[model samples]
Target: MARGCDGSEAGARLRGIYRTKQSPIFLPDFLRSRIHVSVCALICVVGGWPSGTEERVIQPVSNEEIISLALDEIDGERRAEVAGRIAASPDASRTLAAVTIAVQTMRADDSISPPGEVVQRVLGLMRSGVRVRTSLMDVAGQVAEQVREFLCTLVRDTQSEPALAGFRGTTESRHLSFECEIAEIDVQVSRGEGEARRTIRGQVASLTDDTVGRIAWRSTLTGAAEREIAADESGVFVLECPVGVYELSARVGGSVVRIPPISVA
Candidate 1:
């Protein structure tokens, strides 16, 4: 029978290697006794397991880092250190090369130029001081039939001048007018002092009937939900807001009409 022993340094080290008592089932007693000796010999041959308060020997470089290095975004000592690591790794070097080739190919491609007439038309629209934004409900099938009827009414709706330029000195008020098959809407915008901010005073009246409904304004710049404005018995309403572009919507009877974006500035 094998000799039974008390806890000692050699015995404790062997216990650490074969943690489970059932390890004796897989290995014979003779082989189990050599577990500590084999572990020490392997460690001494390989210079010990990688551990301690030393810098890591292997550091992974990400694809974003490789792209940044290729773009010349890094500089000085840090750049040099990362460059050395990238040079030592074959995968990082290949990624940098591929990104550099793609950038060079893009730079070598020819530029595209728009047609002269198209450019002139865009310039004219900007110069006219008229910023027209398309209505969303009109794009959907909701206002398709009404759009054709309103477009014909728009020809007759053209009034004296743009509301943006109508404001006089000190008060800085502007009047905008729009007509459709449903209603003829007129809005007066002006800047307010102190706590009042800016205000939009408007009136909506039916072009075909006596029916009147609600009007609301949504700030396009802030991307907020439309705020409902209550109108008087005479079909007049007032809205106060900060200086920004806005889109107005009026619901009269079963018809809902949305105006284009109006810039406050």
Candidate 2:
């Protein structure tokens, strides 16, 4: 006598039952009853057949959720489920990819240094009421002046240095200093090879004691060439542009400090 069928045999038997149900051939009443009982038992063993209402409902993922997923805020089983949903949705997948790229770019930008201690001290002084007493009209006038564009007078240059032995060998770098009532800017331009771009390094410092802590500045190059860069905490910045005549501007606080057109060769 053979033992009962195993899982594979049971599956085969189930398939046979299905085929039997579809067949028009006549079958004994006893055999039909046994097939029906077996199928019912199999259904119970498998936790019952799935009903029409038991289908999985896919909910659309929102952009915020997708951003959180890209940031790795979602983890474990939920991460897997969200990833599956995103894979199934073209729009969601594109959004996830774009958000991931932007997150990476922001992480890269985090390497920039934060505001220096001088800025902190300035804030402390303002909080302590150590600033000058100014009338509201005076304050308004100052703000208006700051918003206007003003030229910075060139105070010094490398050419001002006395020639050594009446002859100075050619150099590739030029140093310049410009000053205004608000701040002073020092710049160094390094000349590159023929037709190559020039590297400009500069620093901005406050001219008045009250403005010493306002170190946040932005440098911009415009005209025959164009580039812009934010100064670090120490009011230092570097920029590069092709050989051309450009007007350099440093926006310190609300003031726009404009320098004369600089020709680089």
Candidate 3:
């Protein structure tokens, strides 16, 4: 081994010591618990935990490799090695590092346990929230609203497509259009047939809304199970119940419309 001025150790002894040492010089105390990175993020307490808030810097690893490794599915020594690498240097400055870790954790596992202290705290927030760099509260709110709009488009597309397979297949497209159906609000059921029918037909004039026909159905598009919902005058709107099984009473314009369950099955 070529010796450096810093007194570099070489060969088998070095590899063995690095892998098996309980206290490698580079390993952060916070990561020594051998806790799963996910759990470590969640259960890591502030004061009692090995590292203090001031010592909690995960920095100076200019390469993204350490971040990738820290987030890998490995446990024990491998995970420790990755975190240690990230925390090794003092001058690293990737502003997104913390947020990146949090998002990666969630994207990696949905039910990831949070490490109770700082890292986990940020993880929990990012789970149900988005990270915004905006300093203005109004701008932050607007950004959130815009995000919601985009998200609703996705959710509605997902929910509506499967529910309306017979009606259309605009699920994957970014934009879709369909002629609206002018139907009345009503529900009908035939127990003899073990079937329930919900008719979005009737007085179309009195029950029309901007959403009428633009959206295919008024029920939640669930399985052919029992669902409850109110139909607008034009019987166009979002549904709280799934498909086919008509519900008992749906509130429309603050009024309840009761009908025997409808069965599409």
Candidate 4:
């Protein structure tokens, strides 16, 4: 039998095959150690793993965290880490961008002012650390006891203005303002999508305090069905009805404010 090749010669042959073929092959124990070292070196060079550097770990950021970041509530080294991770994640980056834009927009928008008494009450409660909770029925009873009816008087009407009478053409829109003891109502009547239909858009502002919440309102067109809608938090409401005279009413706070019949043509 021919003498077996020496370990050095066998190892060199195995390394040559590994380099040329770039595929797995059975190797002797000594050859395996040599090949492992060569493979590691090749990987460091080809896979862009710099020596003595640890790989970065990316963690997901939550929506609340992103919002806090936008609000500048986060600070120090943690903020930097979170920002880096957010930058690495496309979805998180987009969400953060959207939240930032929304915060900026809200900052630029108008804000409602609460009554001074309400603010003082809130501050007092905060200082005292007392929580005042009222039952729904109790609140309803209080509202009922304070409820009163008032007939709003027309304060201004562009249609009836003598100065505009000469200039008034066949306009499709009209503006009216009414006032009562508790609130003021500004209404815009416009032609609706359908023929012989009218759209009424109105805003109610409390004279005593800010309109705190949604208020129930109704419109009754003469000889037609009544339409009921709730005003938005800002006390804005819209109604569509056939072209006819309408009596509108809004239940604001403890008061029922009613407007006289107004013709919509």
lDDT of 1 by residue, 1-265 (tens): 1111233433443443354333333455677668656655554555554357123333455565677788899999768866886898898899999999998888897988888855664444332222211242333355544532222122222224444464535346777777776788787878766454778888877776656555667766555556778899667988778876776766566566556566665
Query: lDDT of each structure?
Result: 0.60, 0.58, 0.32, 0.62
Residue 196, candidate 3: C-alpha displacement in angstroms: 20
Best by lDDT: 4
Which regions of candidate 1 fall more than 4 Å away from where they truly are? 1-171
Error of 2 at 226 (Å): 4.8
Look at candidate 4 and give me any clashing residue pairs.
Answer: none
lDDT of 2: 0.58
- The stretch of ten residues in a row with the least summed lDDT in candidate 1 is 149-158
lDDT of 3 by residue, 155-253 (tens): 121223455556564332221211112223432211222133222322212233423221122221232222223445455333332223322322223
lDDT of 1 at 71: 88
What C-alpha RMSD separates each model from the true structure?
A: 17.3, 17.7, 21.3, 20.1
Clashing pairs in 1: none
Best of the two (1, 2) by lDDT: 1
lDDT of 2 by residue, 44-137 (tens): 5665543562222344566656887999998997788678878988999999999999989988885756468545533443322111112111
